[model samples]
Target: MKNDITTRRDIEQLVNTFYDKVQRDAIIGPIFIHVAKVNWDHHLPIMYSFWAGILLEERTYVGNPMMIHEALNKKSPLLQYHFDSWVRLFYETVDELFAGRNAEYAKEQGSQIAQLMHHKMRESEQ
Candidate 1:
């Protein structure tokens, strides 16, 4: 089995690999590319820090996800399928790369984040 996420490099790898799939995914790709217009060059490092902080407790990431996703929801309302696909891709990416506490933590955290985003977005719509 592969090693768990132990360093910033592992986090970067996970984020990069996961987003590569996201950028091409049929269900979610357009939301990210056409709608969000994510600049990978800038987004990737922020994500690295985000995951590194989450998985490694590195305390590196400090951004407002709720604000960002809330804005995205306004632009193109995110439905359940979007969160579902995102979580699916996230778990699949984690499974493909590593197998350990941190890996499981990443999946669990991803689920929680997705759920939170979905709930918050729905609330914003009201």
Candidate 2:
């Protein structure tokens, strides 16, 4: 089915599937397992809101994502790798879950965000 602007459920399912893979992946899995302490049931909805805001411009998510990532950065040296993996998983998840422009839009935004974060992290390391 084609994903519309109001594809929060689709996004949530995609995120959950991505996280399931992330939790099992070799390079990036342990990082999330260690840092994200809460149950997926509790975390998924928050992430759903965050992605919903990003994709649909819904004002549902209020947390500062940069701050959260910054905190996580302090705990890991492979920030770029983690971000890359996240973006890759996100794109794959979207491709698997939905058809049409919404998936493309999600990947475009995700790529931009990942690039920006990678630049910032590299700058901070210098």
Candidate 3:
């Protein structure tokens, strides 16, 4: 049986597993690997802290994700479908690894984050 995400380790696992998929996702992979040139070593730990703060209330993350994404969008115009694929992949990741309130909450927050970021990116473009 799968478990509800309840610890930092769980957050790390979720983030790692999700990014494994993201790195291979044809829709967004190049955006990360080629466009953004993400440093996984650097990015993954930040994500662990980010999600842990959100899901565990650890308050360890401190960065402006919107600004970062805005810069990335400037480099490669982010479209609606890219956001859709992101949300889909995030939900798939959470569901695959966990089941419970926290898991559900992660999806809820991820969806909202994606939608808001996508909206802000579009607004900036116009």
Candidate 4:
């Protein structure tokens, strides 16, 4: 049985594996790689901090992801399917790596975050 995500190492593994899938995914890969021009070397650590804070209460992440996404949205025009793909990849990654309360919490939080982001994306259009 897979262990629950219970440490910083677990979060790193989760984030890394998830982004690996994201980088390869045709649906969302271009949005991140081409449109956003994400620098993985720098971005990965920020994601680690972001997820670590959400899952482990590490209090490490400090940035405005919404603003970042808002700017990215202007570049490529984020749509519902983009957010959908993101949430799907995240849930798949979590289920593949871990199983337990924390893992479940991670999925819930991820789905909510995606939903909220999508909502904001729509709001910006109006």
Candidate 5:
């Protein structure tokens, strides 16, 4: 079992694998490619920093995540679905790569973030 503080390398691998799947997923692939235009080559490191901050209590992320997601919501209009898929992929990635307390923490934090994002997206609609 590996530590699950979601290190830079861990985050990188997770995002890479998840996006690889996302690129092929029918429901979510087009949304990400068309709306976010996520250049995996460029975006992965930023995401790594963001996740590192979340799991490690570091300050690697300094930008406004909500604002970014809000923009994405406006484009996708399936924010909840995206959020759910994101969590699902994240859990699967962590489970595949690590275990023990770190993995548990990742699950807990990922679930909470997903729920929070779902709520925020719903709120934005109202």
Candidate 6:
């Protein structure tokens, strides 16, 4: 494990590693590949910016995640299991790559974001 994430490189590393796993995961991979059809070239940098904005206060990320995820849910309704699996991968990736406060914060933030996204998605369905 590396020291806690401290720079853009660290955030990029985390995002890349986590997404690599997501792109191949049995449960979640199809959601990304078939349903969402994510284009990593366009998506990865945005994620880097998103996490950087959260962890480093970079203020580089700009977009409404809830709206995006809500749209995705409309295509293939996200369930608790999906969110749980995502958070699990995220936490695992963080744990694998780094250690210390920022690492913990990354996991915590990922959890909070997943919960919020899941809640909003569910609420929108109702």
Q: Give the TM-score of candidate 5.
A: 0.84
Which residue pairs collide in model 2, if any? Answer: none
Which 10-residue window of candidate 2 scores lowest in summed lDDT? 1-10
Q: For all the candidates, what are their Cα RMSDs to the real structure?
A: 0.8, 2.0, 0.7, 0.7, 2.0, 0.9
Expressed as tens digits, the lDDT of each residue in 10-89 for candidate 2 is 77777788889888888888877876564778778888888888877888887876666666777776566777888888
Q: Which parts of model 3 are misplaced by more than 4 Å?
A: none
Per-residue C-alpha lDDT of model 3 across residues 4-86, encoded as one tens digit per residue = 99999999999999999999999999999999889999999999999999999998899999999998888898899999999
What's each prediction's clash count? 0, 0, 0, 0, 0, 0
Model 5 global lDDT (CA atoms, 0 to 1): 0.75
Estimate, for each residue in 15-114, the C-alpha lDDT of model 6 and write its tens digit: 9999999988998999999999899999999999999998999998899998898888888989999999999999999999899998999899899989
Reference-based TM-score of each model: 0.96, 0.85, 0.97, 0.98, 0.84, 0.97
For 1-126, candidate 4 gives per-residue lDDT tens digits of 999999999999999999999999999999889988899999999999999999999998999999999999898888888888999999999999999999999999999988898899888789
Model 5 spans with C-alpha error above 4 angstroms = 1-7
What is the C-alpha local distance difference test score of each model? 0.91, 0.76, 0.94, 0.94, 0.75, 0.91
Model 2 misplacement above 4 A:
1-5, 36-38
lDDT of 6: 0.91
Superposed model 6: Cα runs more than 4 Å off: none
Q: Total clashes, candidate 3?
A: 0
Task: List where candidate 4 sits over 4 angstroms from the true fold.
Answer: none
Angstrom error of the Cα, residue 85, model 5: value is 2.1
The clash tally of candidate 2 reads 0
Error of 1 at 47 (Å): 0.3
The alpha-carbon lDDT assigned to residue 45 of candidate 2 equals 85
Ranking by TM-score: 4, 3, 6, 1, 2, 5
